[model samples]
Target chain A: MVKLTEEMKTAFSKVKIFPVATASKEGVPNVVPIGFCQLVDDETIWIADNFMVKSLANLEENPNVAIYVWGPETGGCFQIKGKATIISSGEKFDKMKAIVNAAKPGLPAKTLIEVMISDVFQCAPGPEAGKKLL
Target chain B: MVKLTEEMKTAFSKVKIFPVATASKEGVPNVVPIGFCQLVDDETIWIADNFMVKSLANLEENPNVAIYVWGPETGGCFQIKGKATIISSGEKFDKMKAIVNAAKPGLPAKTLIEVMISDVFQCAPGPEAGKKLL
Candidate 1:
């Protein structure tokens, strides 16, 4: 597993929304927009599971997740792939709950998904597109 | 399959960049930022394959695709899922090439992916999140 670079972290932070992609055990792909993903550390990211359905179901079967970090203000582009662990308890879970509740009191923020980064790919236009960066 | 609503078309047009997700035959999920996806018609869309690798390969193995549409100005959020057909020659292909070449003459715009939308799902962060609309 590779750690996300400082540049990648900064670009990720500027993103307003990104897509999280997952696949079921049957190899069926599912994707949804995510707005509560946080860069927890150089090697980990946290996503609040407020209203996931197929995305959560896919994760239950296949732990790997792919997130595309690109928006008008993201500065640059990249893709993050990692193995996700669904956390329903413990310290990180509690912190995630607090953060979501602070922003919107009614958001369930039911669980926290902790993703340990394994790969990062350049998604910027031109020759570097799809090149592995980490 | 269902046709896209006029409202969906309007919102889809506002997105500058969106995420296109695909999976290998073995179900390994992959996602990348897309800037060339077009709402060709109510039930169809097109994506130019200017720079692609794993994404195109995955589509060859499994044509199903998922695209998340959401940006600062998109007005609404939704996910489009469909079967993708890679077009390398003929009418749509020629049109796609012309559009790409006109915008940037040097771009290869190698192929055109015609997506026949089979489903639409709300992704506006509510009880309707992931609820299929079409």
Candidate 2:
């Protein structure tokens, strides 16, 4: 299990949108901007599936996923790669549904995606860019 | 070949950063934020490799790529999926090298990645979200 540093958590919290990427078993890639992603803990992230179609399909085919978090104002970028599990009905799903409903009423929180982070990478443009952080 | 709509072009132009996703042939995923990306044409996008390591390695193994662009102020999001070609030393590479140099001096424009867009999807949070736009 990988642990997220305090700097990484702070940067992720500041991001308004998270771009989540997933690949099918055939290697075709899909990316989507998610507005309802929360860092549940250092090693876990919860993404509320509001309108995810291709991403969900890709996840079903291949559990591997990558999430990019960047602060537009701060210019901090990080990539979190991990395995994702789709929770349709569970306590975590219920909690995520409540959060999503409170944030945007009438939207269906179909599934709550739990990502178990295995690696983290720095995405900022510099010498250490793309270097594994965890 | 696919054509980009005027709305898509405008939204992409307004984005300050582009998050690009790529997967290895084994389906391992990598994502990175790129600051030097430009739309070359309706169906082609150019990304300058400033500080890419895993992303470039993933591209070499699998050409498939996905790019996510979102406007912070307008909240417009689009996902562009395509096949990428890395140009190390060529006319396109030279041109991209010039652009990258102008944008950020001393940064290595190691390669110019040309993405041939195959599909475009709407990523806004609504009923039409995740719908095919092109």
Question: What does the lDDT read for residue A21 in candidate 2?
Answer: 90
Report the C-alpha lDDT of model 1 over B1-134, residue by residue, as the tens digit: 89998889988988877688999888889998777889888999899998888799999989989988887788778988899999999998999999989888998899899999999988889888989899
Show model 1 residue runs off by greater than 4 Å. Answer: none
Candidate 2: tens digits of C-alpha lDDT, residues A27-107:
888888888988899999999998889889989989999988777564577788999999999788999999989988999
What is the alpha-carbon lDDT for the whole of candidate 1?
Answer: 0.88
Error of 1 at A34 (Å): 1.2
Q: What's the count of clashing pairs in each model shown?
A: 0, 0
lDDT of 2 by residue, B1-134 (tens): 69898878888889887878999998888887787888999999999997889889999989999998787554577788899999999799999999988878899999999999999888777789778888
What would the TM-score be for candidate 2 when compared with the true structure?
A: 0.95
RMSD of 1: 1.4
Listed for every candidate in order, the interface RMSD values in angstroms are: 1.1, 1.1
Query: After superposition, which runs of candidate 2 have C-alpha atoms over 4 Å from their true positions?
Result: A73-75, B73-75
